[model samples]
Target: MTTAPAPPTLPRTTGAPVPVVPSRGAGPTRLRALDGLRLLAALMVAAYHYGGRDGEIGDAWGSSPAYQFPTASGFFAYGCLGVQIFFVISGFVICMSGWGRPLRAFFASRVSRLFPAYWAAVILVTVVFALPWVAYEAVSPTDALTNLTMLQMPLGVDRVLGVCWTLWAEMRFYALFALCVVLPGATRGRVALFCAGWTLAAVVAEAADNSVLDIVLMPEYAPFFIGGIGFYLIHRYGSRDTAGWAIVVVSWLLGQHYAVSRLWHPADLPDAFSYRPSLGIVAVITLGYLMIAAIALGKLRWANWRWLTVAGALTYPFYLIHEHLGWVAVHLLHQDLGLPAAATFPLVLVAMLALAWCLYRFVERPLTPRLKRAIMR
Candidate 1:
């Protein structure tokens, strides 16, 4: 359930389309394809939350989600893998952005990217949950305010939207990267060691029973970020990095175990919905890896289209606004208004996408650069 900022797209040209590779001399060249890919990951997460489960999908929608989205539910069940994909993308983009920059600039970049839409989301969800008829749980005003800082999880305050847990994971990743890698200046050797050492440290933390380390390191999500960093090394420095490939392969192998382990221990589901292990889980995870590898190798250079930039712009806001507010809308249309569950699904999806676009266009686009300048100054 983690999310990340979209990578910037390469500028389009008037001449024949040439593949956009990383500059290798100055700053890293942005990949437009990855920007488009971020939107897909957000959509997958949204669909999974909306219609992926069985048994009333939260007891708020009045019917089984499997019954609601009969055909798509099975596929949506695997949508959690989208989080894995997001972390990988996060690794690549963060490394690309952080390379050769001081910690203040990196911190500013992350703050400007993450906080704008997240603040809006917390405010909006708090207002919505305050309405008496809503099905989602309402928390104390103090809890809601704490949620605004993205620190509610560690502070023992209830998350306004359960999906915000991923943001917490993402924030931790940024903190780790800042303090450990960027503090020393992110040279290639340092980053490679950080990726490997983080992997080994996760193991040590787990076996040694250190709760502080467990909380800080987030063992389950670290490998995707490691693999992503490795992928970025290949993209930035070319494929000659044996260390990069080793990091990717090691992370992929560990990623398999950590990812699939969740299948049997799914949180908050009813006892009736058994979590059976499946090869499909592994396949989807592998597919995510392969997709990142493709981008790292420049195989997706032709994907540099302009609209995908718009798609990237919409992704963070779309992800922020989708989950809890979406379910409320679902109840209104399907349960209150007597619409068919199947019919309601697309209607709600289209509505969420439109809402995301409005938020991005009206608020995020204009405000983000100013926020960045302020933070940088």
Candidate 2:
């Protein structure tokens, strides 16, 4: 049977088919590629969790030759890079859709889209873990308040959903960046200066302590957010040529290894600082900025992958529920079936995708439009 046609995206103030972006000539009428890229990223993440050894498993054959291959895990380990991709996409979408609009409308739109389902996930997980006879952390009032507000990141608190720390960062960036854009005299120059200062401060703070505040606001990811904004400007007034994208993509990939090596293993630095702690992450994010630039400039075709789009659409929900239920599923399956890592990994991944697709179609997409209308009103 043929699947029903996907719902049309609601038009934003900028006339784009989505929110959070300001389009000059109606947004790219074609985004199948970006959608596909997102799908690909989500799948990689699933693979990483199920397959990666040494990280969350022991004596589980995760250390086997096949599993240890760099190519196998590196691509997925880089799945965290999907966060950067999301940020860039958000920046473009928001800038085009919400920039220059009334703060009330913009803020409302964001709240309506992000919170309903996300909070639902939080509540679901909390309840599941809190059930009598279940193994779970004792829920505290502070934890409740923090998680509810998604302030766990800036407040330097432990994440309730664990994987949600990244969402918290995204939320904070949206709020902070929007404020910066609309502030009295929040011109491009001022915004640039502020972002630069904030990034530098985060680096300094991370150097002092690896606290949540430092990590959440660190300079490492600043460029990703900024790159989003930069992309908007390019879309608005600059060229959207493929040549530019090629340059950025090539430069980012070729330079990424050196940057990672320098940041994480600081060859020239003295032994006391050999582990230079924060640089590798920074380099990775730097690469992310370049990737976004490449996408915007049309250099990255991976975003054009059809499967990537399908997977990308489910990413948020998949991320939300996967870790919690995934652990339980793995535990039970491993116990009963004694499946090896390879088999377990693929099986769980397929299950997660099936679950995410069902939820997205039945829950998220259905509610999003109505919520958007209510918020816009």
Best by lDDT: 1
Sequence-dependent TM-score of model 2: 0.68
Residues 267-322 of candidate 1 have per-residue lDDT tens digits of 45566443435577788878888888888877887776787767777788788888
Scored against the true structure, residue 304 in model 2 reaches a CA lDDT of 44
TM-score of each: 0.89, 0.68
lDDT of 1 at 44: 89
The segments of candidate 1 whose C-alpha lies over 4 angstroms from its true place after superposition are 1-29, 54-56, 265-276
Clashing pairs in 1: none
CA-lDDT, candidates in order: 0.77, 0.54
lDDT of 1: 0.77
CA shift at 369, candidate 2, in angstroms? 3.8
